[model samples]
Target: MFGKLYLIPVDLGHPSFEALFPTLNREITSTLTHFVVENQKSARRSLKLIFPEIKQGELSLLTLDKNTSELDLNPALDWLKSGKNVGVVSEAGVPSIADPGSLMVKLAHAQNIEVIPLIGPCSIFLALSASGLSGQSFVFHGYIPIDKAEKTRFIKEMEKATGRNQAQIFMETPYRNNQMLEDLLSVCKEDTLLCIACDLTLPNQYIKTQTIGKWKKLKTEDLHKRPCIFILGN
Candidate 1:
C-alpha cells in the first residue's frame, strides 16, 4: 500500500510552531523525512523549527514552485509509492491553496493515495473571517495583474461582482501593495467597501474595512514590504 500524502500548514509569520500548529500536526510533520516544498531553504528552516531534534541532512526535499514541471514531481511520487509518508508544505500558509503544491495533491489522488490536510493559518480565510464580508459566498482571485490598466479593470469588475452580494478577495505582491491600493482607490467607487488585512498573524497586524472615500482621507504609508489581503464588498 502507498503511504499517505500529508498536507502540512506552516506558520503565517507566527513566532513558533506551537503558536500556529497543533501538537498532532507537529508530531506528524516531525516523523516525515520526505517533503515536497516550494522553497528548500525556507522549508528546511521551518522543519528545523518544528522538530529541533531533526537532522537537516536526513530530510529529503523536492522543490515544487511555479517553474516546476510534471516530470520534476515524479521523484516525490516515487517516495510515496515506496511506502514513505510524504509531507507537502508551502513557503507559508497551507500547502496547495495559493501555492503550486496543488499539483502533488492532484497526483496523489490519481494514484489512490490518502491525502490528509493538517490545520493551520490560511491568510485568505483568516482575512475573510475578520473582514465581516460575505464569507458564505466569496471568490478568491489569487493575485491582481501587474499591469496598471489591466489591474484597474480587474478591480472594477470584482467590485461590480461584490456589489451584487458576492464578496471578492485578492492579494498583491508585498512590494506592489501600496501601488495596488492606489489603483484600487482610483478605480473603485467612492462608497465601495474595501478591507485591507496586512501582516496577518504578526505583531503589527492590521485589518480594517471601510469605504474607498473614507480610506482616501487617511494618511497612507508604504505597505511596500508587507503581506496583505484585500477584500471587496458592497
Candidate 2:
C-alpha cells in the first residue's frame, strides 16, 4: 500500500503553538520523520517550537518552494510510494495557500497517495472573517502588481468589483506593505470599506474595517514590515 501525505500548518509569527493548535496536531506531527517544506531553516525552527524534544537529525525536510518543480521532488514522491507517510509544511500558516507546496500535492495525487490536512490558521479566511466584509462572495488575488500605474489600475478593478457586494482580498510582501496601503488609499472611493488585518492570531493583532476616508485620518505607518492582508468591499 502507498503511504499518505499530511499537510501541516505552523504558527503565524506567534511562538505559542499550544494556543493555536490542538493536542492531536502535535501528536501527528511527532509521528512523521519526513516533511516537504517551503524553507528548511524556517521549517526546522517551527518544528522545534512545536515539538521541543524532537531530534533535528532524525527528520528529513525537502524544500518545496515556488521554484521547486516535479523533478526536484522525486525523492519525496518516491518516499510516499515506499509506504512512508510524509508531511508538507510551509514557513507560516497553511501550506500552499499563497505559499508553495502545491506541486508536491499534485504529484502525490497522481500517485494515488492519501492526503490528510490538519486544521490551522489561514490568514486569508481569518482576515475576511474579521473584516466584516461580504464574505459570501470574495476573491483572493494573492500579491498585487509591483508597478505603481498597474497597481492603481488593479486597485480600481478590485474596488469596482466591490459594487457587486464582493470582498476583494489581497496581500503584499511585509516590507512593501506600507506602499500598498498608500496606493489603496489614493485609489479606492471615499466611502468604500477597507480592512487591514495585520499580525493575525498574534497578541498584537490589528484588525480594523474603516472607510477609505477614515483610514486617511489615522496613522498607518505601523503596517511597515509586518505581515498584512488588505480587503476592499462596498
Candidate 3:
C-alpha cells in the first residue's frame, strides 16, 4: 500500500504553534521522515519551533515551490510509493490554500495515495469568521495585481461583486499591504465595508471591519509588511 500524504499547517508569522496546531498534527508531523516543503530553511525553523524534539537529521525535505517542476516531484512520489508517509509543510498556515503544494496533492490523488489533512489554523477562514462577513458565500483572490491600474480595476470589480451579498477576500505581499489599503480607500465607495485582518493569531493581532470612509478617517495600525487579510463586504 502507498503511504499517506499528510497536509501539515504551520504558524503564521508567530512562534505560538502550540495554540494553532493540535496534538494530532504535532504527532503526525513528528513521525514523518519525508516532507515536501516550500522553503526547507524556514520549514526547519518552523519544525524546531513546533516540535523541538523532532530529529532534524532524520528528515528528508524536497523543495516544492512555484518553480518546482513536475519532474522535480519524482523522488517524493517514489518515497510515497515505498510506503513512507510524506508530509506537506507550507511556509505558513495550511498547505495548498493560496500557497504551494497543490500540484503534489493532485499527483498523490492520481497515484491513489491517501491524503490526510491535519487540523490547524487557516488565516483566511479565521479572518472571515471574525470579520463578520458573509462566510456562506465568499471568494478568496490569492493576491491582487502589482500594477496600480490593474489593482484599482480589481478592487472595483470585487466591490461590485460584494454588492450581491458576497464577500471578496484577498491578500497582498506583506510589504505591499499598506499600499493596497490606500488603493482600496481611494477606489472603493465610502459606504463599502472593509475588513482588515492583520497579524492574525499573534499578540498584536488586529482584525477590524469598518467602512472605507471610516477607515480613512481613523489612524490605522502599521500594516506595512504585516501579513494581512482584506475582505470587502456589504
* lDDT by candidate, in order shown: 0.89, 0.91, 0.92
Candidate 3's residue-wise lDDT over 78-114, tens digit each? Answer: 9999999999999998999989999999999999999
By TM-score, how accurate is candidate 1?
0.96
Pull out the clashing pairs in model 3: none
User: Which has the higher lDDT value, candidate number 1 or candidate number 3?
Assistant: 3
lDDT of 3: 0.92
Off by over 4 Å in 1: none
Q: Which 10 consecutive residues of model 3 have the lowest summed lDDT?
A: 17-26
Residue lDDT tens for model 1, 61-176:
99999999888999988999999999998999999887778999999999999999999889998899999889879999998788878888888899999977899999898998
Can you tell me which runs of candidate 2 are displaced by over 4 Å?
none
> Candidate 2: deviation at residue 130, Å?
0.7
Model 2 Cα lDDT, one tens digit per residue, 1-234: 888999988999898887777777889888889999999999999888778888999999889988888899999998999988999999998998998878899899998899998888899989999999998999999998999899999999999999999999999999989888888889888999999999999898999999999999987647988899999998
Q: How far is each candidate from the true structure, as Cα RMSD in Å? A: 1.2, 1.1, 1.0
Model 1 residue-pair collision total: 0
Predicted structure 3, TM vs. truth: 0.97
Assess the local accuracy of residue 185 in candidate 1 as a C-alpha lDDT between 0 and 100.
92
User: Candidate 2 — what's its lDDT?
Assistant: 0.91
